[model samples]
Target: MTGAAPATIVFGAVYATVVGLCVGSFLNVVAWRLPRGESIVRPRSRCPHCSASIAARDNVPLLSFVILRGRCRTCGESIAWRYPAVEAGSGVLWLASWLVFGPTFDGLLAAVFCSLMLVLAIIDASHLLLPDPLTWGGIGVGLAGSFAVSWTTPRDALFGAAVGAGGLLLLIGLWYLLRRVRGMGLGDVKMLAAVGAFLGVGGTLLTLFLASLIGALAGLLLMVRGRLGWSSRLPFGVFLAMGAVVSLFFGPRLIAAYASLL
Candidate 1:
């Protein structure tokens, strides 16, 4: 890493963080409306409790939430903490991406990928839904980005997508044949395809491994706590998002380490 001036790096980080926060705010809107099959652009943000239109000032991302003490200004109804949390988390992720990849094409791609994953993770966690707009759009972006970015080739992206989706389908089919029950949803397969498009085949495989490892741990914990049973479905998309993010940042090192071990 270049020993750039502290001020310059700080300025870049702040700029990226601000952009991420704005994107996060928009993502929150998308998450709320997409699952309901409502137009995200139409019927501007409103208080769910009182059905009052939100003013521009009251919708200023994290600032507005803090100013209002996490309540709707129009109705005084308590707002979900997820609003500010997502905004803050997005900002941190943007900052991290900028720091990792710097001001470059790869940095831009990482930031965009992180943003999409964050939004999808939140949607899946909250509503158990991963909309096509994000998954399919992500695959398109990944393929297009590979042309400009040096990390992966277009061929790798295509191969990754095919393998990711195909592997999941195979697993689902086998599980259904053996257990007469669905093992996973199409959304997960599509989401993995998107991740593979962005990260290529090796990264996609790593993502699946990491997601499964963490998800199994989480399920075991939940079961032990009596919060979940064997039949309870976990939001698998959230784990995939987590794995994608991890693989995005550390995949090269991880692959290199594994190769060394071998």
Candidate 2:
């Protein structure tokens, strides 16, 4: 499909980025509350250190962090930089989605996919937990987007979900048999299934390969820093989310390049 004019694209990207920043603020709530089994809506974002309610002015995504100097206004406790970082990262991802897919339904779907991946990545990295709401909800959204957008057919999305979950399940079983321990969590399997629903089998496979490559690199880095050992657990979901984002943007070109090389 033809893209929009340069001016229109620029405007759309900016608009999407702004909306993403707001969404990222809410995502912070989701990542924090969901793992704790708390209601994200009712609590209204209090400082974890002092239990002071955040004012509306203090909750303006990246801007608030800057204004507050990354400290709680009430108690001066240091706020995590991850809050503003997620907001900025989400804005960038939204801008990238609009740039790649243009101002179309596909662009909206891409933005939503990226947002979900971001939330999953953050939760997994911090808590080593991937909640069902994000994973299962993402699967539903991905399947709906499959029919709504031109990225993949429904059949391919279905196959992708099945293979993504099934492949991981098999690997986990094998690991258990060989090591007498569960190597992968069900959350990772479900998250992959959700990714497959969006990306199809080829993209899912590419995500797995990319996740493995990056995860190994990260593990090596941790080991070198004396932070990890052979028995240390690494959060695989974060790498999977990263790989899915990369595949979302570049899977087609990457697959084509590999095919040409073959």
Instruction: Report lDDT per candidate.
Output: 0.91, 0.91
* CA-only RMSD, every prediction: 1.3, 1.5
* Runs of candidate 1 exceeding 4 Å displacement: 1-3
Task: Output the lDDT of residue 97, model 2.
Answer: 90
Range of the 10 consecutive residues with the lowest summed lDDT in candidate 1: 175-184
Q: TM-score of the candidate numbered 2?
A: 0.95
Count of clashing pairs, candidate 2: 0
Which pairs clash in the backbone of model 2? Answer: none
* Best-matching candidate per lDDT: 2
Cα misplacement distance, residue 247 of candidate 1 (Å): 0.3
Error of 1 at 203 (Å): 1.0
Q: Which residue runs does candidate 2 get wrong by more than 4 Å? A: 1-5
Task: For residues 142-245, write the lDDT of model 1, one tens digit per residue.
Answer: 99998888789999999999989998888789978898877579999999999999989998999999998999999999999999976678999999999999
Error of 1 at 200 (Å): 0.7
